[model samples]
Target chain A: SQQGEEDPQALSIQEGENATMNCSYKTSINNLQWYRQNSGRGLVHLILIRSNEREKHSGRLRVTLDTSKKSSSLLITASRAADTASYFCATVGFYNQGGKLIFGQGTELSVKP
Target chain B: EPEVTQTPSHQVTQMGQEVILRCVPISNHLYFYWYRQILGQKVEFLVSFYNNEISEKSEIFDDQFSVERPDGSNFTLKIRSTKLEDSAMYFCASSEMGGSSNQPQHFGDGTRLSIL
Candidate 1:
C-alpha cells in the first residue's frame, strides 16, 4: 500500500490567496512532516507534527495532523508568487525505518501574480 | 546556516556501469539518508545510515545498491550495475537526531542521474 497520498494534484491561485493541501496515509505514524520543492530542486522542510500534537505553525505556514483519520493538511496563508511549488506530506512509522520517511505524491501549487 | 552538499548536479551513465553519488551531511548530524524521485514522482526513501552502518533500507535498496561512510565527512551510495530505471534525482539528507526527537531533515539540492 502507498504510505502517503496527496489530493488535488494541481492548484492555481492568485497572490494573497490561501492554499490548502490535504494528505492521507495508510497507517499509524510516529510523526508527519510537510515539505516544499521548487522546480528541479530538493525538498525543503516546512513543518512537523508529532502523533501527539494536533497542530503546528511556522511563520505563515500551518500544519494539522489527525491521527484518528490518518490525514493531515498544510495551509499556506497569504501566498505569494514565490510560493509557487509542490508541497508534500511525509510520515515516519512502523513501516518506515527510524528516520526514514514515506512521502506523498505531492500537490503542485501555482500562485500567480 | 549549514547545508547538506551533493556532488555533480547531474550525471549521465551508460546502463550496466557502476555509479556512485556522494554527499557531505551537516557536521553535527548523527543520521544520514538517501532518497530519490523520478520526474514528477514522490520522493522515495532509499536507505538510512547512522554510526557508519545502515540502520534501515527500503526494498528498492537491493544488493546492487550499497552505502558507505568512508570518512567522517562523506557518505556515498554506489550502484554496482545501473539500469534504465535507476535514473532519478538522488538526494542526501541529514538530521541532528532521529525518531521521537522530531528533528526535521535537511536536504541537498540533489544529483540527477540519467542512465543511457
Candidate 2:
C-alpha cells in the first residue's frame, strides 16, 4: 500500500508563477525525497530532506519537511513550461533497508507558456 | 552523469506467459529495486535487492514475482506467469546506500509491459 499522499491531484499555472505541492505520509521516515517525471518518461531525482532537517534547496527547487505533521512540501520558485511534470514524494522508513521507497500518488503540474 | 538502464522499452505478451525485465544499475551502486505503476495509479514498490539477497519486498510482490542479480552488473525481475492486470510500467532504480543513509535512488526509463 502507498504510505504517502500528495495534495492537489493536478495544478495548472502560467509561466513565472510559483508552484507548491504538499505530501503527507503515514509513518515515521528516515528521510523524504521528491522526484519529477516527464510525460512517458522516467522519474528524476529532485531533492531529499532528512527527518532531522526541516528544509532544503537545490537550484529553483525547495523542499520542506515537518515531522510533527508527517508532511512535506515542494516549491518551485519560478515555473516554466519545461517545469511541467508529475511530482512524487517518497519515504524511506527508519527500518527499511536497501533503500526501499514507498511513493505517493503524484501531483501533476502544468506550466503554460 | 551515470543512470540506471532498462532494456526493451516496451513488451507485449499474452496471459500466462513468462517475462523477464532486465536492468543495469549505476556501476557503483549496491542497492537495486523494482517498482511498477499501473495506468492512472500511484507507483508501487515491488522488491529491493542488495548483497545478492532480497533485502525487502512489499505485499504486492508475490510468489509469481522474483528478482535476481545474476551478474555483477545486471539485475532482473521475472514474472512466472503474467496476468492481464499485470500490464503496467515497470521501473528500475538503484542507490549508493541503503535506507539508513540519505542518498536518493536513481530511476531508469520504465518498461511498458502490455499483457493481452
Which RMSD values do the candidates have, in order?
Answer: 1.2, 0.9
* B51-110: candidate 2 lDDT, tens digit per residue: 999998888899999999988999999999999999999999999989998899999999
| C-alpha local distance difference test of each model | 0.92, 0.93
DockQ computed for model 1 against the true two-chain complex using alpha carbons: 0.68
**What residue runs in model 2 are displaced by over 4 Å at the alpha carbon?**
none
Best by TM-score: 2
Question: Model 1, range A1-113, lDDT digits (tens) per residue?
Answer: 54757988999999999999999999878889999999999899999899899999999999998888999999999999999999999988844546788899999999999
Candidate 1 deviant stretches above 4 angstroms = A94-97
DockQ top scorer: 2
**Reference contacts recovered by each candidate, as fractions?**
0.69, 0.94
Candidate 1 per-residue C-alpha lDDT over B30-99 given as tens digits, one digit per residue, 9 for 90 to 100: 9999999998788999999988889999899999999999999999999999999999999999999886
Positional deviation of A67 in candidate 1, in angstroms? 0.8
Using all chains and alpha carbons, the TM-scores for the candidates as numbered come to: 0.97, 0.98
TM-score of chain A of 2: 0.97
**Residue lDDT tens for model 2, A1-86:** 43767998999999999999999999889999999999899999999999899999999999999999999999998899999999
Clashes (N, CA, C under 3 Å) per candidate: 0, 0
